[model samples]
Target: MASTTVADGIVDRLIDWDVARVFGYAGDGVDPILAALRRKEDRIELVTARHEEMAAFMATGNAKYGGGPGVCLATQGPGAIHLLQGLYDAKLDRRPVVALVGQVVSTALGSGYQQEVDLHTLFKDVCAQYLQVAASPQQLPHVLDNAFRTALATSSPVCVIVPHDVQQAQAPEPGQQEHGIVVSSTAYARPRTIPDVDDLESAADLLCAGRRVAILVGQGAAGAEGPLREIAERLGAGITTSLLGKPLLDESLPYHCGVMGHLGTTASADLMAGCDTLLIVGSNDPWTEYYPAPGQAKAVQVDVAARNIGTKFPVDVALVGDAVSTLNALVPLLPAQAGWRPEVERSVTAWREVAGQRVAQRPSRLNPQLVVHELSEHLPADAQVAVDVGSVTYWYARFLRLPPGVPAHLSSTLASMGSAMPYGIAAKLLHPDRPVVALAGDGAMQMNGLSELITVADRWRGWADPRFVVLVLNNGDLAEVSWEQREMEGDPRFPTSQAVPSFPYAAYADLLGLRGLRVEDPARVGPVWAEALAADRPVVVEAVVDPDVPLLPPRQPEQKVRQTLRALEREAEGGQAHELLRAQRAHEEAR
Candidate 1:
C-alpha cells in the first residue's frame, strides 16, 4: 500500500503555493480534506466559520488584499449552496477565489443523499470555470492544475468538486502532473496601449486654453495616484474621484473636491460643472449622471480598455493608454500657469463649511453624521476599515476617505449582509502586519458568522489590540431598508418587532474571548472608537443610532430612485441606447 493518501496530494499542492490559511466549516462531506488540511497546519492554517458562506467571503477578502486566488471549502447541499453569494461577489469584483465543495461518495452523488444537489449545475454559471474531479487513480494533478490555472488567468471564481469517496481513496503512483504548476502571475488580458505623444500634447493644449479644468478619477485609475496628483499640481486643476476611487486622494488633502455620480455632492458637481474642461482619467461611465450635467464641460476620456474610449460622451480626445503612463507623457506638454485650481479648492472649502454649518445647527441626539465626522478625524492613516451593507454603506461610501489601495472590503451589486465579520477575518490573514476594523449594522449582523471572531483571536493570540473591531450602528431594526421602503411606497407597516431586537453583542464577544463595548451616548463615541482602535485583539462596539434619523433620506429616495429607474428603463427599452443604461455604453445620459 502506498504511504501517501489522495488527501495528502491535494493539500500538498495548496501548501506549495504559499497559501497561508484556508477558510471553511466542517461537515461530513469535507471531513477527509479537513483532516488532511490540519496535518499541514504549520504551513497552511485552517480557518473555520460557523457557516460556509462566511468562509467564501473571508477567502475573497484575503485574495483582494493579498493579490492572489483565495481558497474556500464547504460540504454538500446547503453548505455549497450558501457559498454562492460571496463567490458571486468575488466574480463581479474581479477577485480570484476558488471553492472546494465536498460531494457524497461518487456512487451516491446523483442518488440524492441527505444534502445532495448537482453542484456542477448549481455553480457552473456563477463561476468562470467549474470542474468535477474524477474518483480514479490516474486523474491526479490534472484536476488540481486546472483549478489554479483558471482562477488566476481569468481573475474570476472557479470550482473543484471533490467527491467524498475520491477524497478518501488511496493515492496513485507518482506522476508528472502532481508537481506541475507553472507558478506564474497572470498578465492583464487587456493592457492599456501607449498613446501618441502628439495626441497627448494636442489634448494638453486644449486643457491649457480652458479657464477651469478638473480631473476625474475612476476605478480604472487603480495605480495612477502619484501621476494624477502631479498632473493636478502641474496644471493647477481640481481633483475629484469616483465612488471606487475614494481613497486615491485623502479627503483631508487640500486639492480634494467631492465625489462624482448620483451619490455625488452638490458642491462637487457644481464646481466641476463650472470648469471649461473635464479630464476623465481611467473611467468608462457612459451616463452623464456620473459625470457633470449636459454641457457642463467639454470632456476628454482616457482608458486602458480601448473599447471604453469615446463610448460615453462625444470625446474631444480619446487617449488610448494606461492612466499613469498617459499622465506622465502629458505632463511635459503643458505650460505652467497658476489657473483655476485655487478657485476650485476655495469653492470646495466653502461648500464643506456650509454643510458643516448646517450640520452644526441640527443638534440631533444619536446623529450618525456626527459619528462619521468624528470617526473620520480620529482613525489612523494605516488602519483598515471594512463596512456592511445598509445605512452605513451609504454614509461611508459617500464620505469615508481612508486613502486609496487600502482595500475597504465591502459588497457591491448584491449588497448582501454579514460580509463584515468574514471579510475582517480575511483581511487579518492578508494584512497580518496591520490592523483591520469592520463597521457593520445591528440588524445586518443578525445573519450569523459571529464565530469568526475566534479566528482573529487565534491569529492575534487573544491580545487586546485593535486588529479587528466591529462597530455596530444599532438603531434597533432593519431601519435602513425599512426607511428606504417607507419613502419609496408608503409601506409603513412592514415589520418592526425585530427592528429594535437586542442580542448580547457584547456577550458573544466575551464568549469568543474578545473585548466588547456598548456606546449608548453619542458623546462617548469618539473616545470609545479610539479605545477600540488601540486594542490588540478583536473588539466589538454596539452603537445605538437614532432609528428616526435619516438612514437614506426621510423623503428623498423616490425622486432620486425614480429618475435612476426611468433613465435605466429608457436605456433598457431601446438598443445601442441601452449602453447608457447598460453601463457598458458611454454617452446615453450625456446625450
Candidate 2:
C-alpha cells in the first residue's frame, strides 16, 4: 500500500469534519490532491463544475442550504482568481465556506514562473477571516482545522493554500511529536448566546411603549421563527423581511408585510412609514431609504455580532445575542398593543390587492409576475428554490409565496447574476430526494446559466428525485437595468446596451435530453409549471414575458415617476410601457 501523502491527509481531515463533497475543477497544480480524492472517492465526492467560479458558487450554496462549512478546491493563478466572486458571495451573505486552493511548487516561489500569480493578494479580501499557506507536511490538520474552525465561528469564507511540493510530501506518522509539529482537531460548536438582563429589559421597555411596532428580519433570524411569531403576536407588530430573510417567515401571517426595499411590497413600505417602534432582528439590510425616517421610530437592534447593531439604523438599545434567545428573553416583558393590529392588517390587505392586480394584468406578452404567481399553488412543500438577480428577482420577491419550511436562497448582498443554476445544482446534490426550482432571466441565462445546464444534465441521472425545474424569463432585454436608467437617470431605454440576444432556451434543454416546456400565452403559464414540476426528468420552463411591464418601486416618488415617464416618452415603442408605468403608480397612490 502507498504511504499516506500530505494530500491524502488533507482529504482525511476534510472527512473528519464531515464534509461530504468538495466542489472544484482539476488542474496540474493540484494533481496530487486530485489523486487523493480519487483514492478516497467512497468517503468524499468531488463535484466538478464548468468553471472554477461556479465551483466556488456551488460551495457557497452548499453552506447556505446544508448549514455547514462548505469546502471548495481550485488550482493556482486563474483558478484562484475565479473563486473570488463566489467567496465574496459567501462573505457578503455571511455563510461559512472553506476554499482549499492549490499553489505552484515551493521551489517556484518568486521565480516569476508561468501561472505564478500572487494568490495571497487575490484572496486576502474575500478570505479576510482566515487565510494561510501550508508550508510543511506536518501542518496537515493544523491549517485545515483552523480554516474550518474560523469559517464556522465567523460565518465567513476562509482559505488554505497548499503548495504542489508540500502536497506530494509524506504525511507525518500518527502520534509523532516533534518540536516543529502542531496538532489540531476538527471540533467546533456554536455558542448559545443570550443578552444580559439590563439590555433585554431596555429593549422590552422600548417595545412596550410603541403603539405601532414594526419588526425587520434577515437571514440571521432563521430557526427562530416560532419565537418571532409569538413575539409579533404579543406586541401586535407588523413584520417585514429583507430579501435574504423572506424564506425564514411565513407570508400568510395577517400582519406580515413582504420584503422591504426597492423591490419590496407596498405593505412593507407602509409598515416602515407608519411604525413608532422598530425592532430589527439579525438584519443589516442596506436599504436605509426604505426604513422609517430618522426619529420616526425608537429602534432596538438584536444581532449576534455587535458591530452589525446600529450600523443600518439608529438603535436606542442594542441586544447582542442569537435571535432565538434574544427574542425569547424579551417576550415576557412586552405588553400587547392590540390597537396596532388593524393598521398592520390593512397594509397587508392593500398589498395583496396590488400584487393580484399586477399579476393578473394582460400585457402585450405574458406577464413574468403571472409565471411566478402560478407556482405558489403547485410548488412542492419539500422543494428548494434558487433565484438569479435581475427583473426576475423583483417578480420572485413580490409574486412567489414559498411554502412554509421550504428553503429559498439568492445572492442578495452581492446580487450576482448567473447564480441560480449553480445554486440549484448544489441544493439538488445535497438533498437528492428533494426537488429544486431555479428562476433566472434571459440575461442571466446567457451569462453563465447556459453552461451550467450541462452540469445539471450530467448529474440529474444520479438524483433520487430528478425534478430540477428551471424557469427562464425570456424578455430579450436586461429589464432591470433598463428600468433603472429610466427611473434613476431619466434616460430612455438604450437598445444597444440593454437588448439581450435571443436564444431558444427551451429547445437547448431538449437537445440536452431534458424535458423542455415553452409558454408564450398567459393561459399556458400554470399548465407549463405543473408539467415541469411533474416531469420524469429535469425540465426547463421558458416563459416569454413582456419587458414593457414596469418594475416600479413601491411608493415611488412623483419626481422619479415624472423622470421615468419623460424617458419612456422618448423611446420608439415606449407608449405601452409608459401607460403601464402610469397605471402602476396610480395603483400605489390609490392604496
Top candidate by TM-score: 2
Residue 387, model 2, lDDT: 97
Q: Indicate the worst ten consecutive residues by lDDT in candidate 2.
A: 174-183
**Candidate 2 local accuracy as lDDT?**
0.93
User: Against the true structure, whose lDDT is highest?
Assistant: 2
lDDT digits (tens) for residues 473-569 of candidate 1: 7767775665455444543424544354678886678778888887767678789888888776678877766554443321123465444334333
Each prediction's whole-model lDDT (CA)? 0.69, 0.93
Cα RMSD, each candidate? 7.9, 1.0
Which TM-score value belongs to model 2? 0.99
Off by over 4 Å in 2: 1-3
lDDT tens digits, residue span 93-129, model 2: 9999999999999999999987998898888999999
Against the true structure, what is each candidate's TM-score?
A: 0.81, 0.99
Error of 2 at 382 (Å): 0.6
**Residue 552 of model 2, lDDT score:** 94
